[model samples]
Target: MKFQLDQPQGGNSISRHDGQHVWVNGRQHGASLLVPWRGEVQDWALARFDDLSEAHFEQILALKPELVIFGSGAKLRFARPALYRALIAARIGLETMDLGAACRTYNVLASEGRSVLAALLIEAA
Candidate 1:
């Protein structure tokens, strides 16, 4: 689906998303990725939800976002809390949702200037 929102100045916002891809700031990305409110969008090495590990969350922790919106591909699934223990220890909030919802929610929070990261898992189509 495509989104039309008044983007916050100088910030990145999700412009579109579907099962196989997402568009950030008008650029299309075909793989799983990390979308921070600002800064370059990063290709997350996660190819499937079942492959998630603490190391993945640790990578996100390094980015230091106040909150993370984890998109579990086309379905709403929660990760093992133990996998993200480091994030909890650091006082960062984590929310899980299906891909589409994550994209929308990330845009809303990002537009509000919140330090949010969208850790989306875009599985192969």
Candidate 2:
């Protein structure tokens, strides 16, 4: 499947794929596992916090997603133990990766049949 995202002013449009890839202005952005999902792509603004502890929880609360993909910049990091526990409590699945990887994962999951939401912090490339 292919999606056409509107380009922001002075920015390029992002073409998302059902597989593990995203195209920005016709260039592949990243590589990742192709996990298809059934949901909408939710965008949120985040601030600097000690890890993605609250951000994950808040996004889950707001989006009510079956699964959440966190795009934590350019490197993969496990969510804080507290956050993981919270997710478990809420019965929400959580996956963390770098921004690009998260984007790919989001597209994959969205393509499949899982209800997915993404909280990303990546610069446009």
Candidate 3:
């Protein structure tokens, strides 16, 4: 499974998969995982953050994915209510999980043709 990145819309970007891992402007991004071209291209937004609460919500909003997965690095926690509410207002589903879990979930959802966005914080393993 490869991921191909379309030219960014401003600082934000949309990456489509060709086969393997996800790429941003031809550079591989470890923060994201891309599955093979299944059928319909699933839309996704990915952002890296040090603190999930401080992440820029506008980016996710711009993508307008059906589901939002918050990757809280190696540690997992509930997302702030404000963030959840914002997604709810946009009619997006929100899932908060560890980064690894989120990555796996993103790949599975993408393969299944479900729209998903991921905010991942990388931690030293």
- Tell me the lDDT of model 2 at 79: 64
Per-model TM values vs. the true structure:
0.94, 0.57, 0.58
> Compared with the true structure, what per-residue lDDT tens digits does model 2 show for residues 12-58?
33355333345544565443222223233333443333444665475
C-alpha lDDT (0 to 100) for residue 99 of candidate 3: 60
Which lDDT tens digits does candidate 1 get at residues 27-91? 99999999988898998999999999999999999999999999999999999999999999999
In angstroms, the error of model 2 at 93 is 0.6
Residues forming the 10-long window of minimal summed lDDT in candidate 1: 1-10
Which candidate number has the best TM-score? 1
> For model 1, what is the C-alpha lDDT against the true structure?
0.94
| Clash pairs for candidate 1 | none
Per-residue alpha-carbon lDDT of model 3 for 1-125, expressed as tens digits? Answer: 75753332222232432223444334555443322222222223333333444235655666677887766656686767775566778787878887667656676676556666665544333
Clashing pairs in 3: 1-19, 1-20, 2-19, 2-20
Tell me each candidate's RMSD, in Å, in order: 3.2, 8.5, 8.6
- Ranking of all candidate structures by their lDDT, best first: 1, 2, 3
Candidate 2 C-alpha error for residue 63, in Å: 1.4
What is the RMSD, in Å, between candidate 1 and the native fold over all Cα? Answer: 3.2
